[model samples]
Target: MIVGTAGHIDHGKTALLEALTGQAGDQRREERERGMTIDLGYRYAALTPGAPLTGFIDVPGHERFIHNMLAGAQGIDLVLLVVAADDGVMPQTREHLAIVELLGIARALVVISKCDRVEPQRVQEVQTQVSVLLAAGPYAGAAPFMVSSVTGEGIEPLRRALLAAQSEVSQRSREGGFRLAIDRAFAVAGAGIVVTGTALDGRVQLGDTLLLGKAGKPVRVRGLHAQNQPATEAHAGQRVALNISAERLQLEQVHRGDWLLAEWLHAPTQRLDIELQLLASELRAFEHFSPVHVHLGTQDVTARVALLQGEQLLPGARMFAQLLTNAPLQAVHGDRLVLRDQRAQRTLGGGRVLDPFAPARQRRSEARLAQLQALASADSLEQALPALLACDDGGLDPQRLERQFNRLRSSWQLPANAQVIATRQGPLLFTREHWQALQNSVLEGLARFHTQEPDQLGPDRDRLRRFVALALERPAFISLVDELLAANRMSSSGPWLHLPEHRIRLSDADALLWSQLQPLLVDGAFDPPWVRDLAKALSVDEAEVRVLLRKLGRLGQVHQVVRDLFYPEATIRQMAAMLLQLASDDPVVQVAAFRDVLGIGRKRSVQILEYFDRIGLTRRVGDRRQIRADNALAQSPGQ
Candidate 1:
């Protein structure tokens, strides 16, 4: 369990910590000279034998160092809100209490420090004032504990209360990828670089490689100390110091706001959609697009708030808003953030992040707002999945979804009967109802296409994708088309896709022309003739010959490799088989290997390979091509 001290400057926050742990606070020369805490101080104690250690973070109480104080507030399980008995409730004391309350720190032990200096009546009066302060907000029932660091009075009782609260500290699950917001980084003599911060999620072991910061530089964990003791591994909910090693990595590259994270969790974004609340103590309303200093984790960046619902947010009111930052920051859903005025002088309010990767357009659309509302209400990824799928019309990106929840893919609790469509990019998740709607749209679209153009076989895959008029990704749309084809609910005639019942045949005149063209194409088999050559051989007009061949191309009798060049349907199938056989041995089929396989010249092979790419028979990768098994032409003729 971690406890943080919060109160006014010179209010005995550091002195109380010193007395509790028997460790001196205000260690810095500047702090000692001034008799004040200028930065955060750390100490630990084992309240119970054979139990985990209790860590203490004594934060600076001066308003100028509030940002420093905030850096230590993260991962705290309980707050020690201190108020000097002589001073009663001071300005900084109220501000510190408000900041903790806005941060959603519910467990607190309000302490009236320096009780020895004041009379008994004065101590009681301060206690009564602190009780009233706690009576409001989330800490309504919290009681005060009076203690004096100098006299050792009420100190034992406070220690006993903290020991009892240990059992109540809920352990954070170490289920996701490792993440630690670095608050301090420096170099040691022989240990190389060392970084200390709170482990936010997952676990890390000695020798494990973690991506450092937004650059995703890989670094090995040489050793670590968890909860102030040397350990081989460290998990979430503990204060940790890691000795890391990497090639060419310097102390300058690692900053206080940087993060040590699992490789896949290194994404940083400039925009965040959050559920914000303006502090009731604010003198003015929070105007939309107002400049503010956003503090999340240990990083502070400038940003402008974009209200999702209204032009301004009144004090004490909660609303969904988007924060646009000037610099990128690492964030995840449910992470808390604090906002200060543009000048970075005072606290305005804070909120919990709802989405770290917010879209740039249509962010305030009705559907998007509904999705944000659902996200705000959900307590976990499991509860949000269904609601998100229902409200998100553009479908869910599986990678983004996993990152939003800070959950590993293996640990995701997917909704029952959830449909995951395999795409080239990755898998796309959809609910059954949405999946059905997409399928219905495709079938209905084909039906309308048949009605509009009875002469044509149907639209090709690319055309059909556009005709559907939906916001489906190309890979996802292709997967849906393949699913429909495999189920016999749809059919593909070479490059064209249509309803299984819809078929096209050549007219009588075109059939006669095809008869003359068919033999010529079959005879030329491997090296087909151009439209002009075929027209010259048949003693027919070039335009007439081209028109007839196009008709046959739609009927799946011949393949138009190019605008003029054509191949018999049988020849194209033979070429597809040869490419597939080459892919069977090695998925990447080079132009040279394919030319040898076809026993054709390099030019002809290149032409055919380019044509295969156009018809989706293969995907080109630099000088090679990968045969696509999902393509209709790649299948055997019997199928």
Candidate 2:
């Protein structure tokens, strides 16, 4: 379990954490001298025997470093909201509370620190004020404990409260795609590089290769630890320390905002759709397209906000908005964010991310805004999957879908009876309705091809690709084709593809043409006449001749030579026989001799010889032809 500290500046958040864990959270010399936290700090607490170890993230409480606080808060499983009994709720305290609420932190233990500094009556007064302030926050009804880190008063009660809160703490979603928001990066003498963060989703183990966001660099996990003890694997809600084998990276280079993730899981974007809520106590109103500082996970970015409902947003109003930023962010849907108005220099509101990687836009329609709102409210896979499919302008990539819906895929146990089409080009998600429609389209295409070219085996694969491309604009259409093949609804042979029942056949006219043309191929030197000439000879119309020729070509009963000339299978066989006979008598045969032996003119002779050369029957040597030594005919006797 991961616990995060939140409170106002100089409220002793780090001190309380140190007293609880016996570890100094503040490692910076300046922070120790100045007596204030300027950066994120870390400590660990050993739970009662038989309980899980707990890790704590001590965050800065100063308004200037609230961004750092947000970064630490991103991966915490539970929050420890600290309020000094003397000062009660301060500015940063409220801001931190707002951030925790937006981050969807539901389990918390409110701490009223510095109980020794105030009289009993004053402590009671401060507690009352703190209670009222938290009444509307995430910890509205949470149990508030009084503790003095200096004297360790009420320390055991605080521990008991935290342990009790653990029971109400909801288990992390175990199935989502893996995301690790890096908070601490350092170098180990012999271990190379190491990073530590709370594992947000999925599980990670030793030897797994993870991809760093944006950079796409592959890093191998050499070791893993949980709460200072070496472990083989770590799951969601656990604080994990990963030792990477790559070249050691600088602390600043890795930074707090970077993410270590499963390869190809998500793409970074500079825009997001968010459901925002302004605090009731905020003094100023937010105008449309106002500039603000946006903080999510561990990254701080300047964003221009586009209000969804109106021009001026009043305090405490829930609204949908788009955050457009110049810096790219590595985020996912359902992530939480904090926005601060640039002019007011005060934390304005908090929101949940709807589209983590959305395109930048100035003007959007009501329908689109409604779609974003729907996505924000989606809770289950059934609700979310369809919305994702609908939003995918082109077909989604199956590999991407598998990764994006990782949690859903495992828990939902998607039925195998449902057909999912995957093409080489894209993954097309199909509900039962979409799958049936695709089946109907494919059957119809095959039926049309059969009616138009009955003698042909089926449609050409290229033609089918073109047809599907025209019907489905997204890459997912290819996935549909794969589904058809897997279901045995379709079959492919060479460049041709068809429904299961498709076959090749020749028409009566084509049969007659084959019979008439077969005997003419005796000498292996005949150039069949053009379609018009064949029509005149056979006493048939030009269209009839063309139909017969096309059918013959499809059946492999004839070979087209140039535009109008053709040869039957028998012609090719006879040509091969004559060439074999000539090659048995001499190592080489001149083109003229071969042409004379075949009793053909120079044009037809050159064509036949070229065909032989193409098939490795003979090799061209300048103006002459030589029998290919590797040819099977060389082993046979014929002189």
- Please, what is the whole-model Cα lDDT of each candidate in the order they appear? 0.87, 0.73
Per-residue lDDT of 1-639 in model 1, one digit per residue for the tens? 889999999999988988888888538898888888988899988765776789999999998999998888877889998999999998888888888877777688878899989899998888888878777677776777778899899899998888888778888889888999898898999889999998989999999999998788999999899999999999998999999999999999999888899888888999999999999889888899999999888898999999999999999999999999999888888888899999988999999999999988888899899999999999789888888988765568878977888887788878885788887778888888889899999999999999998878888887898898877877888889989999999998767888999988767888788888888889887788889999999999999998888877777767888788889878898888878888889989999999998888999999999999987888999999998765667767323
Model 1's alpha-carbon lDDT is 0.87
Which regions in candidate 2 have their CA more than 4 angstroms from the true location? 247-252, 307-313, 359-374, 386-397, 403-412, 415-418, 435-471, 474-639
Give the per-residue lDDT digits (tens) of candidate 2, residues 219-321.
8899999776799988888888898765544445576677888775756777777888887888778789989988877778898998877888888988888
The residue-level lDDT of candidate 2 at 320 comes to 83
How do all models score by TM-score?
0.89, 0.68
Candidate 2 residue-wise lDDT at 83: 93
The parts of candidate 1 lying over 4 Å away from their true place are 48-51, 119-125, 522-533, 559-639
Which candidate ranks first by TM-score, i.e. highest?
Answer: 1
Question: Distance (Å) between predicted and true CA of 345, model 2?
Answer: 3.3
